[model samples]
Target: MTVVRAKLGAHLHSMTAPFLFVGSGLSRRYIGTEDWEGLLRKFAALTPRPYEFYRTSAEGDLPAVASKIAEAFYDIWWDSDDFSSSRKKWAGSMEGRESALKVEIAKYLSVPPALTGLANRESLEIEILKKAVIDGVITTNYDSLLA
Candidate 1:
């Protein structure tokens, strides 16, 4: 979680906020088998269009290629009203969805390295954050996981 903390610190410094707010989202730790299936389902919901779009595009500039992938991801992310709205609520109007996704992606990136040698790999620091945010953690990304 140090990376998460460091990034957050850098962000707060850059923003120089009179008011700063945070909301919790899902970690892999929160996901159960069913929840995992559900998130995969959501991801699957958007994959085909993006995949096809990318497939059809003959010329691929690196930036354009990346943008195409993002557009596809956004298709899945934005389609579900509850999912999209929860993100907005958790993020408030101040933070962008990309910022939220970055934090989540970072957590996913960091967890594997940190837990590499552990016995019970799934249960770790995320539990503490989960407890702290029982009421406040409002993102739909992990709702099924927590439930």
Candidate 2:
């Protein structure tokens, strides 16, 4: 979150405050969300094929690999006890066989992580940003941390 403080001040205006554009890094710093590849790797573990298989099959295209992984998870999600509650909650959104992977991803991200690991610098950054005069917060991330 140090970037929040640093960048917010750079474009301040007297008439109108600046809007902070937070990319995908906030979760990585605050909650340690893995990068896209690593995130898919976690889900890949549930499938019969290894993550490397998906990587090779997709020819290094992460989105393609994600889709393939989602296809794999669709088969597992319908029968796995691990996703029983998820199946009940998301049966509507699944559209018969799709979006189960997204449901799993949302479930994983929605669980709050422990904040005890916050460093002194990050704490100070939070304090500084709390007092920052800004028009609003914007983030590429889908989480509601700023919203």
Candidate 3:
């Protein structure tokens, strides 16, 4: 372990511009964002169907479940004729529900101000990485933490 650490330190010192590939687990660990199942469950609660229907029907496919939820939300939003004039105009001008769904999910996953504590080892590591002269960061997470 000591040898590996020394080698990694040497490599980091020698490397010119390193790139990062971040995953959802990093945000989940540091910022307390929900996992796929948890996120789906939240959205499922908004629908008339039980959460388990979406959770189990997806068979571990989160993207499918997300699509289903977005469709349902779109239908609900479209069918509602009770919106105020301003809201009606806004809703009519909108393009698609998928974009709105993404916005909602991003809001949900955002790290709250109180959860920004960086005293832990994981956060410390992220801080170090932020200070490094990296070339770029590639992440699969939908949140804008890297930005």
Candidate 4:
């Protein structure tokens, strides 16, 4: 770990310019104003174990939970419309929301293990190297307040 950090530190230090490719991990937090988090929190409140599920990765398939979350989003959008819409519209909206929501949920479950491995790398960059993100950080996380 230390060796890898040293090598990366050396590489970064040698570079004429400084930049960091900070990704969604730095932005996404379980706490936020997003309807997704609210749904998850509500699910936790109703379930036998909320925090446990939040901390642990979903067992087996996650599609069921993902669907539930998707349904919640669709319901909200539908409620906002003053006039009744066809099922196709709701389905389309649900499909789009479902795709993005599922990706995020899967990312949430998978990111921790991946990040754990990179923890040393980040630590070395932040603490030992004291590198700066010279070009500024860019991310596409909707939950993030970068905009």
Candidate 5:
């Protein structure tokens, strides 16, 4: 373990441009973001059906679950005559909930408190990541912290 760590450290130091590919776990740990199921459950609560129905129906297929939830959301949005002008306009322009899901995920993952004073709260791992001479940080994460 010590040897591997030393070798990895050497390699990281020598690399000119290393890209970090982060996932939702990083956000969950540092920013307290929900996992995919948790996010789905939250959105499902807004639908007419109970959250468990959506949860069980998805059977671990998040994209499909999101599509189902999106349909429900569209229905709600369509039936509501009380929406603000801006909201109504936005809903009218939306093609589907996929984009809206991305927006919602981004909002949930982006915790302002976690990012504030980041430089002052750097951990050893964070410091090492900072030391890497990277051309860019690539992530599938929806949050703007890495941006």
Candidate 6:
């Protein structure tokens, strides 16, 4: 890990404000968000089938399982009154569609992680990162944690 970090640090130092490629692991460490499979499994609980079934059926292909979950979840979302608020909110845009999965993901990630009351090195790191002289930011993260 140290070697990887050192190499990446050297690479970043070479470029003038190079775009940083942040991934899920960074969010997992900083904010306690689940990894991809764990996130898929969490949504799978709302589907007709268990998470394991989707995993096995998809041959452990997580994206495939995610598609399956999306399809099943759409049915539930459209037919249930519990999601009426979702429907009303997203009406005329993505209503009566499988896009509820996107909304669910957004809602799941919208909550910012609590970083207060931290008199620690990591908090100092965050402060430094906030003042970092990067050209811009790029991330695969779905949340607005850095925004």
TM-score of each: 0.30, 0.81, 0.66, 0.33, 0.65, 0.78
The whole-model C-alpha lDDT of candidate 5 against the native structure comes to 0.65
The sequence of per-residue lDDT tens digits that candidate 4 reaches over residues 7-111 is 999998888764556444554332223344443665444334453454344452344554554555444434544214433333454456455444334434433
The TM-score that candidate 3 achieves is 0.66
Best model per lDDT: 2
Which stretches of candidate 6 lie above 4 Å from their native place?
1-15, 95-97, 117-119
- By TM-score, the best candidate is 2
Candidates by TM-score, descending order: 2, 6, 3, 5, 4, 1
Clashes of 1: 0
Tens digit of lDDT per residue, candidate 1, span 50-96?
33355346254434443454455553555656456545655454344
- Please, what is the whole-model Cα lDDT of each candidate in the order they appear? 0.44, 0.80, 0.68, 0.46, 0.65, 0.79
For 44-125, candidate 3 gives per-residue lDDT tens digits of 7767887778657777577888877777766654554532442454655567776545555665666443435666887678
> Roughly what TM-score does model 6 have, to 2 decimal places?
0.78
**In model 5, which range of ten residues has the least summed lDDT?**
80-89
89-126, model 5: which lDDT tens digit per residue? 46555666564545444555565636444544555556
Off by over 4 Å in 1: 1-46, 50-52, 55-58, 81-90, 93-107, 110-147
Query: Model 5: how far is 121 from its true place, Å?
Result: 7.8
**Residue 42's lDDT in candidate 5:** 82
Model 3 alpha-carbon drift over 4 Å, by segment: 1-15, 76-93, 97-99, 110-115
* Residue 81 displacement (Å), model 3: 12
Relative to the true structure, candidate 1 reaches a TM of 0.30
TM-score of 5: 0.65
Q: Candidate 5 regions off by >4 Å?
A: 1-15, 79-89, 97-113, 116-128
